[model samples]
Target: MLSTNPFALSDTRAPLYFSDKVALVTGGASGIGMATAELLAREGARVVIADRCRDDGEELAARLRHEYGQALFVETDVGCASSVQALVGRTLLEYGRIDCAINNAGLSETPVDLIDASGEQWERLMAVNLRGVWLSMQHQIRAMLDAGRGAIVNVSSRTGLVGKPRLAIYTASKHGVLGLTRSAAIDYAPHGIRINAVCPGLIHTPFVEQKFGDGLPELARTMNPLGRIGRPEEVAECIAWLCSDAASFVVGVSLPVDGGAVA
Candidate 1:
């Protein structure tokens, strides 16, 4: 059973303003994706949790079923065009329409020197972190177009907006994400779909811990001006709001959920 009290309720079921909407969160198995899925479910949206990790994705979906009874797990490799198309197809088949999508599935810092980075690494990162978003948006927007309304939040990194040393491929992929977000936002707003990107700073998630080290959370926390790394729930809150009607006017925005990291 999903705990009723998660220490971050935010005023009782988050106003239930999202009732009846369908949401698909890529990378919905762990970290920021998991957090966003839980929040969306709590807000009364039927959620499709898609990820490459079937074990974790199925487990999370089952838990959500036990809690909210409106979650589905779809095994997806966003890097593959066919897989992304199938994901959207399944979502529409199950839910009738998609109201929102969070393209949160991404890769960690493959910290390689720019000059030393091979074409293979570059292509690999682009396939998932960049091309994945493109393919997802392609299929997702097609469905939303038929419905005539939807929203999209692509999970970008602070590095996407700026640059981070030693992770050339990752950085380039993020930059591509922002470009995609902006272009799609402009092209889709006419169809009643809004496209935006969320740029998150260092957050306390399993990915971060594994990438940096067990003690990396402490390091990330202190590196920020706020003296603490961000939490998954914090990023989730931003996504939930962006996916909600409350942000209807928001489009083509690259909102940074960083703690003064850009400053």
Candidate 2:
């Protein structure tokens, strides 16, 4: 059986590679985004948690500040361009520059056959899953361009690589994210900025718990070779690595953190 406490903070004592750097995480109120924010802050990055869940976001930020040294929460709707723009603006105003970013905000679709998929569902998924990444990248790239260097990690999913029976809209949105990551990486590589993606399998996040409930663990066991669901911190580690100088040579790669599920 896989370790039960996969989210344990044992690894938080790693070297402070992110000292003096500033990092931003969208959808950071909970789950993989929250894990990433905490990990980055632990590694010495001034973190900004941006999400629409005001209560949760603010609470997470406060906890981060109490544990780490610096953290801020900005209420944001990644689906709205203005909200995203303001998020970036506020981060810049406070930190002066964005050294790293994890565009983790996204929405998933309820299982429904493509034939029965509503246009509204498609639009909603695209707005947050695809367009949010695009919008976040636009402002993030501009900031990196000004600073002359940066790193970005867009959180895609294993679904982005393979299609599910009733998840066409989600699959499409995630695929779009990979396209955006690759295209943006190429465009910004020469300018000293790197972009990449992480395709997580079934992670045990609050979102996953809400969507799948008690069935999630059994489903996870059958889906991945490791025979268990992944933890948010597991994926968060990948995001932090991609954002660090250690991954300076890594760019435009869609890393699968799926416990051999994609293998």
Candidate 3:
């Protein structure tokens, strides 16, 4: 039902569909997470940015609060059960409820062939990308159940639905994210909680730079049918819509925000 271009952030006066909502975004210090946090705050949601990057987290929170006055940053390692618990507890204590959550804290390993991928590296990627989402969803769903309404957007990737060479661990972890999103949606939809995922193509963000470096620009331009990589804000828009009332009927779906890359 969201007819407006979900990839464009040009509509400045667009409605604050999330006004009064208390939203939380993990891995909110940079890339799509940060862009999503900024957009949510601009839409009048009180946002809690949870990330392990202390300085960037604080700086982003400060910038949002100074500009919008409804942003808070909490240092969190989503992979840790204790840290995740404290994150949910603190958010409730500070804001009284959690209306939405975006679990985006994830890392990619250096490219390695399937046979070359080490057990430790695979486990490490799983710990953060898969287990982290599981923990965050467990707590967020608990909070939302008490309040009787909520939405969750897991930051998945195009690689989740398609295999890519030399990225064994990362692809496996992302595929797990898709599985989690579907299962959680089925379990919580009756409870008024919606769970979905955004599988983005290459996007211009710090994370992409870390993963692909100078080659990313060229990669993005020619990677898909659209002939370009995506921007962080473009991915953020899809996430924002999935979190909004406009996407009320959308649930348990892995919507691809790719530039026709998976097609």
Cα lDDT of model 1 by residue, 70-99, tens digit:
899999999998999999999999999999
The candidate 1 region of ten consecutive residues with least summed lDDT is: 6-15
Steric clash pairs (candidate 3): 220-229
List TM-score per model, in order: 0.93, 0.94, 0.94
lDDT for 76 in candidate 2 is 97
Q: For model 3, how does the per-residue alpha-carbon lDDT over 149-244 read when each residue is reduced to its tens digit?
A: 999999989999999999988998999999999999999999999999999888888767787887877787789998888888888888999999
C-alpha RMSD values across all candidates: 3.5, 3.8, 2.6
Q: How accurate is candidate 2 locally (lDDT)?
A: 0.92
Q: Cα lDDT for residue 127, model 1?
A: 92
Candidate 3 Cα outliers beyond 4 Å, as residue runs: 1-15
Q: What's the distance in Å from true for residue 39, model 3? A: 0.3
Give the 10-residue window scoring lowest on summed lDDT in candidate 3. 6-15
lDDT comparing candidate 3 with the true structure: 0.91
- Backbone clashes for every candidate come to 1, 0, 1
